[model samples]
Target: MTAGVLSPRARPRLGFLGVGWIGRNRLEAVARSGQAELVAVSDPAEVAARAAAEAAGGCAVLPDLDALLEAGLDGLVVATPSAAHAEQAIRALRRGVAVFCQKPLARDAAEAARVVAAAREADRLLGVDLSYRFVRGVPELRRLVQAGELGRIYAVELAFHNAYGPDKPWFYDARLSGGGCVMDLAIHLVDLALWTLGFPAVRHVESRLFAGGAPARGRSGPVEDYAAATLTLDGGAAVRLACSWKLPAGQDCVIEAAFYGTGGGAALRNVGGSFFDFTVDRFRGTARERLAGPPDAWGGRAAVGWAAALAEGARFDPAVEGVVAVHEALDRIYGA
Candidate 1:
């Protein structure tokens, strides 16, 4: 949560390793931020690679990771499928290139640890676009909670229910996606809650996962379309999380988090089930105060922030360890 999304320091040369929609969108965000130079892009699909390159005002469109690394990039943005995130990020790091990857970081905690270890070994900057942290009201909530304004927070309720989920085939395959709604949507809730609460230790985790209206027996089996989990953090705080995809949710999405503490309570809720509009409210007795509201351009701030930090010569941030922590909690939720 800096003043500007992009750094004002020297612009770093960057490459996009996967130019699918998310990849291309982040590329455009960085390009628009003017914090980095787009050197090259590579994707297995020629259409996507070329489209992303064109979107960057015609950067070099290469064939693969090798060509991208050979472009002399100072940084790489990995937006491939979930299964590819860890390996691609590791390869980029080993090449001495900084990396900002899309979420899940890896399918599970072990894979995530490997990527983080690689980044530490290479002494490079590693970032993941967990995106929610950049949301306008979210950072403010984090500030309040960490500042002890929300004294002794005892409970957190978070949810993300998407009316229409991923349209990709890989998402339905647990091996490819890691998990369903939980992996795709609930991950944000988990990250936001932990990050806001300053990453407390999870004393225990319990959960129920369902896919196709049946229990998801194992992580390696069916992909969960609905999930509800409870995380008991140190200090006896209970974090409740629920997420689903293609549910009869009556709206586009339901994304919200409510925090209750001894001193006060606050909540961040979406407006009209719109993904982009959100409001944060503080509650004292029966009264409420608005902390933040819509018209905030936060969608791409995570990607932009990473690039900006790179321009400022940031390297090997220890905060990347939080990524590992998030995935570890995910593992426990899946009964690991």
Candidate 2:
């Protein structure tokens, strides 16, 4: 095994798994950071893995996680199937490797909790792709809420509607995806609401699921096309979230999260239905103020943050325990 490329400043040696678009995008961010060395990559698609390896300027292409782990990596970045995340990440963590995985880190609450527990037991860093938390403007919004600038945060309304559905077949398979748009999209909203509010306990939750434009049944397993849920938090604060795939929303997508407080309110809304552009604003009585607008490249922020944290020798963050809560809330929504 090569001497792992821990940065001169204590950066970690990193490996990329499943180098598809999302995976490569994160690789690019990690490369730009100079915080870690890209040592190995693994993907079932030879062409995709080769492309990603080329992007890394001759990084090794390992055949599987076992091979990748043998390279002596400090961490792994997983952008694989939803059904695979928990198992893969657990395996890596068991080997004392940190992990940064795309959202829904597991098929459901139990699986997600197990992954978190593995990291906790291994004394390693673990992160999910809840990328929206790293939005440049959102931190400021959170600061405002913390400072009471938003007064008492009484309610939150979040939405994520995509006109385009997943091209992958696994997305529609209940057992594979865990759930449809809810797990894939609304997870971001749930993470956003809880993180912003300091992760309050969910007091109650009610949800509706649909598939093929009709109410879902127990046999749906993990299949769901649309999901809408209302959660009441411990403080009596309320959160409303709706997410759907292939909606006739007249735009490519509609994404927004708004917070309402006793004193004022604020929201981050997408522009031109573009997934990549967003505007944040503060609203009062009758006037609106902008907090942040487009030109913000935020997608890879979460992965980059994880890479940076791994570089610093971060252990399991107490915040990771929040993943447990998030999943518990998700379970409630699914009536599991």
Candidate 3:
């Protein structure tokens, strides 16, 4: 149902499907936005679920996804493990519930497509938390590229290196977490590159995967700790990406997305190795102009945006098509 046609309640009832740290953060964001009413929460861990319920001022602590679905929610916020994203989102959508999920959306393109199809059939809103696009300067950077202020963009560079890897066992398993650093960190890079350039067709992709500094040619074993890939877009712009976990970077993290064109250049870079702080700049010859910078509470924006849209009675957005396309490139990166 579209807005003003079958308007949702003034405050759409939402359910938290996973109450982990990321999940709770998004929950608070949506709640604080005053766009939706959180009515229920579900997680495998009772402690986490109870903690989130208390944080939400005593929303019902449900048992699982089924119970949450039964709580009459207009939307479901999914923050579960990577492998469970597709199944959980599809199930929720088919129940006529909107879904806001943490990305990869699914492990591969095929799974992502199925989830999107379910949303289409149900005519329900579907959103993925690809939060980097909400970073302060990213929108300005995108505007510069799309507006052709950067001229004919030629090469793009992306990188994300975490000095410390994941602390969870599931993250090390390719089967469970999809891939390692690429899935965890580079997904943002890919999303940023494609998004900044308006989701152009990916013409070609070349990749190198490594685990413990050794070549990792397949996903059958442990996930890669390091990955490098170059993608040729529809118009021949080259986008190169490198991301890793636990590398000796002498800092907490290193992240950047830089674009060079005939007329000028632009970039979004982390400041002081801080994941939460970023600065964007545009360059023309020897002169560089600042675009935007830090202290942005962007991590929860993707989810909160979806909540606001759902409360406005938005449904079945075709923009989700681009998210499925994102997986197509990710699959190619993994040789899937």
Among the numbered candidates, top lDDT falls to 3
**Would you estimate the TM-scores of all the predictions?**
0.96, 0.96, 0.97
RMSD of candidates 1 onward, in order: 3.8, 1.9, 2.1
Per-residue lDDT for 249-334 in model 1, tens only?
89999999999999898898999989889999988889999988998878779989998889998888998999889998999999
Q: Give lDDT tens digits, candidate 3, residues 187-265.
A: 8899899988999999999999999989997576778999999999999999999999999999999999999998899
Off by over 4 Å in 2: 1-8, 218-222
lDDT of 2 by residue, 1-336 (tens): 422434435868889999998999999888887878899999999999999998887899999988988889889999998899999999998887889998889888899989999999988889999888877689988888888898999999999999998999998886888878887888888988998888988988888888878887522664777888899998888999999999999999999999999999988899999999998899998899988988998988888888888887687886787877887787777772
The C-alpha local distance difference test score for the whole of candidate 1 amounts to: 0.88
Kindly give the stretch of ten consecutive residues in candidate 1 with the minimal lDDT sum.
Answer: 1-10
Q: Give the TM-score of candidate 2.
A: 0.96
Question: lDDT score, residue 121, model 2?
Answer: 92
**Local distance difference test, per candidate?**
0.88, 0.87, 0.89
**What are the clash counts of all predictions, listed in order?**
1, 3, 0
Model 1 steric clash total: 1
Candidate 3 off by > 4 Å: 1-9
- Which of candidates 2 and 3 is the stronger one according to TM-score? 3
